[model samples]
Target: MSDKSDERKRAARDRLEQQRELDRARERRRRTLIVATAVVGVLALAAVVGLIAANAGKDDHDSQAGPVATPSGATGKDGLTLQVGADDAPSTLTVWEDFRCPVCAQFEDAFRDTIAELADSGQIKVDYHLATIIDGNLGGSGSLRAANAAACAQDAGEFAAYHDVLYRNQPAESDDSFADNSRLIELAGSVDGLDTPAFRNCVEDGTYDSWVEKSNTAFGEGGFQGTPTALLNGESIFPKKGDEEISVAHLKKWVAEANKGRKPATAGATPSP
Candidate 1:
């Protein structure tokens, strides 16, 4: 072959090889794209499944029966009386609580079971007085809204259930953590037989404003300095300074002492003169 012909043939072969390499690179890219798409699809499916499982768990735990009144007659100074235990119960225990207070939450958890047991056994009656001392700290009107919503819930006969849910979902003490009206209404809907429409309307219109204000005033007048303040048989049950632990033993001792000569007062009963 002549030299020029040989050079032309070599150039043709080089061109063909380049085209083949380009085809292979395109194929590799296509395969990579396919694998990436499959991985993304699997991840999305996993996330959806996780969300469903979480929702199911929450539903199971959130289902609770309505309030169970243990029935005793005791009324606060504000004329807000609750039937706590049996009529023959020896004494009454009153707890003033703020929904947004962490200390109140701790005290509730510590003494709730004991109080419930005593109420169940017809040994004592318990009344929970809701107040809004933490309103200023919670930024929004969450403290007032929650307290009002609770009263509305109580009116609908779902107070205990609503109460439990409120504490369970209480946000941290910060401006952003305040529970809004919508959130309160949403929580009210979780309780069985709770009139959602009525609850929402009441919350929006601040229907319980007067009632909440009265309770707040009564709480202040009753000499409660802070949230989680307790009273045994209508007298302040002051825990010793630094003895913040409201253990079962201490509570039982207090109740026993309070019941020595105490009698069950009537509902809406005022404090003794």
Candidate 2:
């Protein structure tokens, strides 16, 4: 009987020792799993941070692209303005536009004829300022490319015609079709005498890319809200002027009022109004 009792105690002790070994093994596995998960979490965080830094660096590089090549006949501060009428006109119509902005296209469609007539009559001068806000917001280079192409057209002395053509053939805001130099060149065919080798070279080479970037930076620094920001004689007059909603008649009336006593721009006068 004593031998049997000792044997039973030994068997119980063996079972307890085996259970402790299993518990230790489970604890070791749990600790390893926790360490592996932490390592993976850190790696993922590092990857995200690296991606952000890389994108920010890319943006900085793009904003400061090589030397600026100002377009021919460009005027105003830093040669950023693309004037579309006699500079001596009594009233100056300042238009800040983005090629990829649908609202700007709409505004152009609505007021293109009236604005053209007013500009032609020497009653108002149009100062066009290009911006690339859409490209920054929508993750594409269409705005920059199109603006550069337009600057090329300005170099070719077909800025007015090409400007109208771009709006007429403007693609959907989401479509980055204008980013293609070939597409911009194809559009240039609509403007007579504007699709020459020199113009094509300018578009392909992005001669004014830095200039466009500078203009975009200025737009951001100007405290302006959005595209199609139209101002008349330094007063905001788009969609509404004071309490009156902007219309074709209202636009004409406003120009007439501004030019009440002022003489129309005489031929051969100094270009600066």
Best by lDDT: 2
lDDT of 1 by residue, 85-126 (tens): 555577877778888888877776776678777776666767
Which ten contiguous residues of candidate 2 have the minimum total lDDT?
264-273
Alpha-carbon RMSD of each model: 18.0, 6.9
- Backbone clash count, each prediction separately: 4, 0
Candidate 1 differs from the real structure by a C-alpha RMSD in angstroms, to one decimal, of: 18.0
lDDT of each: 0.70, 0.90
For candidate 2, the clash count comes to: 0
Candidate 2 per-residue lDDT over residues 63-98, each given as its tens digit: 886557899888999999998888678899999999
Instruction: Tell me the lDDT of model 2 at 100.
Output: 89
